[model samples]
Target: MKKYYLRAAFIIAVGLFISGCAGKSDLSLNIINGEKLEENQLLTTKNSIYLVNGGDGMKTTYLSVVYGEEIAEGSGLAAVNIANEQLCAYTAPVVLEKLVITEKEALENAKLNQSDYVIYSRVEKWTDPLGINCTVGYYTDEASVVLSLYSTKDEKLLNTTRLSKSSCPFKINNIPVSTGSAEILYEELFANWKNNMFAKVSK
Candidate 1:
């Protein structure tokens, strides 16, 4: 009787653990349509730009809790910062300012700063895959972002761009142990996105 009770308790605990690990999360995005900016039309010093966080749209199953928070704060902000740095490094040297404001406050801040353009970006997708095999596992991280440039003068949509990248397969000898996979994945994804964006915009 005692042995049977212990076995039942163990099964229940295993079931609960599996259920928790199987949890998933979803992130929705607000998308808008607009013209696409050409590579030669990158911003210049004369054009003042304001950047705002547009949130993240992620649908992930593996490591959702850990990756979701990162998408909320890490991916979107990283892309904007990288873009700003690249803009400053342009031949004409564009000045980009960070505007920590909500969507409602965006237009008002743009008006006050006389910003020619307001750029809003959101993380469209984020995924972290942890393989099932405990000894040798394959992992992959992917991130995608949608960038929109708006005319602050008229509050009209100007241009929109979407960028996405994924890291190569990561082979992990220990599947049960987290090797800071989420951090490494986002870093690589954001860096690749930034470089690709710069290549498209920079002269």
Candidate 2:
């Protein structure tokens, strides 16, 4: 009965685009679409999962609801250090959470469905829509992640994959990406990023 990881930290990094631009998508949607990719792999007993550098979404999936949404891009690591104090109680099979964390923690925890897993996400890109003119800048970012699940019982691989994405949306008609209103757009991109990754896994 030692400390467990129930909390997470979020980091959103932003920097100017050098000059190499890439094509972006135009469609916008809510609840970003996700399609489970073909994972055909099973589980093994020699490995353990680690959710590193990415946001808190992964932690929310397996940890308690109290720590739900506790970590994400730019989250404080100190908060995780503190929450670990109560983490031991959650390590039991009866306390294992869900495949993915929602807004609420299930009143009665259940045994682990799978073996141990790891989630790692990193935001490598952020920028304004407009340039130096102040009328055409926008905020955009790229996130990359890897999820690993090791089975102490199986000694194989289960539900594992490596995912990486650099998401950004520029004004098609020169409308200029707005930083003040970027939250909505940023959320949209993040949602898409998350959905796509999950889609690949679910399949």
Candidate 3:
């Protein structure tokens, strides 16, 4: 549950760009915490799924504070897109397009969809080094999110996992690159979370 505060003076213009042969990312994800039911929570092959927007659309604190709501919403939508793409492995999840601020509403939507389970996510921390010196750009971005799984059958919480990524490094020709937003780090976080959730549910 770490909070990232952006300095008002760090806000910079949007014209900065770096050019280079993009190298493999140096991003590594960490599991901040996770919880699960004592009973096995494995999923069957062809299960109905729903994803409730857990207020990530307008709740990105540092992004909104630094780059305005438009940038924040874009980053938040990137998160949703990641979830949608990755969840297609099982089935194209029924995703709630609008932000749902309350868990009750989220669960109700899942129930209405007749989903076997529902996934909910909240962005916890985000850091964008827009003004940080580009010379030292190895692992400058960071993002964190908490994902919870609920069984719509009984409307009971089944599992929760918090994943974080702060080690994403953009490089070209082996040179580090710094961007104005934390989108890269956020992608890494969501990708890792997807893998983790699949592992847990398949167990």
The number of the candidate with the highest TM-score is 3
Residue pairs with colliding backbones in model 1 are none
Kindly list the per-residue Cα lDDT of model 3 for residues 107-145, writing each as its tens digit.
787777888888777765555554332223432355666
The per-model lDDT (C-alpha) reads: 0.54, 0.30, 0.57
| lDDT of model 2 at position 102 | 23
RMSD of each: 13.2, 19.7, 12.6
| Poorly placed runs, candidate 2 (over 4 Å) | 1-140, 155-160, 176-203
Q: State the lDDT of candidate 1 residue by residue for 1-203, as single tens digits.
A: 99999999999998777555542222222234654346664445556667777765554554544654333345556556666665555433333445345655776777787777777766676555554331112234455677777778888776566655444332333333333233444455445533443334434
Query: Could you tell which candidate, 1 or 3, scores higher by TM-score?
Result: 3
Highest-scoring model, lDDT:
3
Candidate 1 wrong stretches, greater than 4 Å: 1-32, 38-42, 57-72, 91-100, 127-139, 169-203
Question: Worst lDDT window (10 residues) for model 3?
Answer: 8-17
Where does the lowest 10-residue lDDT sum fall in candidate 2?
102-111
